[model samples]
Target: MSITVNPDWWKTLFDEVYLMTDARSVCNEDITRLEVDVICELLPIRSQSKILDLCGGHGRHSLELCARGFSCCTLLDYSQVLIDYAKARAAECNLSIEAVQSDARSTGFPDESFDHVLIMGNSLGYIKGPADSQIMSEAFRLLRPGGWFLVDVTDKSAIKRDFNPEAWHEINDDTVVCRKREIKGDTIHAREMVLNKQKGLIRDQTYAIRLYGSQTLASLLEAAGFQQVTVRTGFSPHASKGNYGFMNNRMLATGRKM
Candidate 1:
């Protein structure tokens, strides 16, 4: 019998220490660091504001916020490995942050628990199940009136124009990478793959993620009672796309719960 490895298995092999005091230094992985800076620019954070980093793998953002003096910073994700790494980082930094292993679709928390709920870094696409809409709805449920949620994903238009099987690349013996784009009815599909090579092929896996464009994301958030929803196309001032769904840098999505 042969076993098939997965893309998400890299986290299992690597020491995913995501949430340490020095997380920023650890996360200077170019793209990830750029994402962190962009979100901080968009958020109206204050010393007393409370924030929840949903699907906050390794608590990097949460820890950063905590360091910035947010009243309460919470990191929630279903990945225990990621959480453990985050916790280790928090301990080293001696920061008082809360990290929870919980599902984004159902946090089992009380209503209106956070002021700013963040689900970025393409986490929105990982929940490929019947409960995806439920996750968004539940995120809305966890917010108080006027709460904000920021989500990030690939631009559907970009993916449609540039996606292909040839987008994949192999970096080294320990890394095999690929990118793909597909469309399934109303939803657009974009994925990133990375493989870790072992002695032969025992160490191989892929990290696949999907994304929804502005229209679908806006409609879903609005249907869930989020008002004054705004789209940031990353390249525009005010983080607004000005009725144009096309832009660059990285997708910066911002919405408010009415």
Candidate 2:
């Protein structure tokens, strides 16, 4: 078996093209509101709850939570660009949110400080090797007793079953992005190319992400001292009832620190 090396492409990819490609899906006001509402239904959030948005790119979730009357919100992401953008947005909106640029594996926050933690947008597989476990451990350490930890990730089983080699998306009227994927062992290698009307070909990047099945992820969470772990599938708003199996494309994993 070959070892997986972390090139840490996220440090660069998230600067411009990433925002251009995903802004509509992640930063839209209506979508953010719906996602926040779903989270509210799943977690016991209160006005005074101290929530930490782990790996919260751009702080959309944190902003929505604060708008919903949750005063204590901290948004943490490794991308300084995204963090700075989120801070500016928060400042413009006159919302008091703490934005921190830090690695998720070691957040450096005090133990048992937050009431709830969120890791969304499938940001769990960025680090290689045992780092996933360390990320979970950090989440456990940051949450107080009875605190909820919510995670969203792509369903690896489904992706493996229906692996597509190439896909393309129109980022904007004049920009397009294409992605080609290859699965080697437990890691998925993605090569992304971006084309712009003005600049022609702009970016060509490659990255690797480890794929985790439901059982594997649950085991990691449990080993990290999280109890009552539950893994559900198909969290999209348009997903039908009972769309929560290996065939589903997305998974939502929840656990409580006790």
Candidate 3:
């Protein structure tokens, strides 16, 4: 018997994209009731501020901000498929949000174009290379001085303190899986064990990701020319103190161009 397998670390193993989409809808439905409040605080959205949702997959936050009277809220993503979905969502909501397909590191926007920029939903952790610096630099270039740029990412402490490098749980009645990984300089070595639950036997799969720390990320952002880098706890500072088995849950970093 043949079994499909996951090879892409956290994204493929657990594959939380659906959860992300559902989370997006939840954030939109309740507006302020979300996991990350730091984005709102750093937005500087004065009802007239021009906002750009950088790498915004489905316009969730953009749509919410628009409802709150943001002068301009544009959704920018690299995937045309996601862009199409986002545009359709905007249309369905009767909102005139601009949806564009563009790389986050090289968005084709003029200098000082937006007053506030939001890169959220743990999207910042996906980019895994030196190019991250370029993305940060581009963010600085895209916004006016003192403009807000909010980034949502996993806290380094949380990840280091809790990342189960070796573990697995049941995915279905027919499959159970576990994985292990090791970081060696610039690369990740990984392995996974999968069992066919129905057959009461073991199957196969794997996962890997290049490790990065918050300090490494901060340096990248700083070198990109962002100033006043500030980190916040939780999804939004307004969270009612939820615990994630660690002191830091998710972190939001806000930097201003100055």
Model 2 TM-score is: 0.91
What order do candidates take by TM-score, descending? 2, 1, 3
- Per-model TM values vs. the true structure: 0.74, 0.91, 0.70
lDDT top scorer: 2
The sequence of per-residue lDDT tens digits that candidate 3 reaches over residues 1-258 is: 222224333333322333222332333455333432345655666877788888777677787777666748888877666678778777887887888988888999999999988886556534455556777888899999889888766565555656555655555556655556554454345565656745654434443443445666566668888888877654433244332211136567778898
Ranking by lDDT: 2, 1, 3
lDDT tens readout by residue for model 1, 1-258: 222335444334333422221232335444354556777787676677678888878787777777666749889888888888789988998887889988888898899998888886556654445555787788889887878878765566655554453354444456554544445544444344455566333322333345567787787677777777877663432233222111233456677887
Residue pairs with backbone atoms closer than 3 Å in model 3 (clashes) = 35-235, 36-235, 36-236, 37-235, 37-236, 194-203
Model 2 sits at a Cα RMSD from the real structure of 3.6
Clashing residue pairs in candidate 2, if any? none
Candidate 2 wrongly placed segments (more than 4 Å): 1-6, 238-248
Candidate with top TM-score is 2
Better of 2 and 3 by lDDT: 2
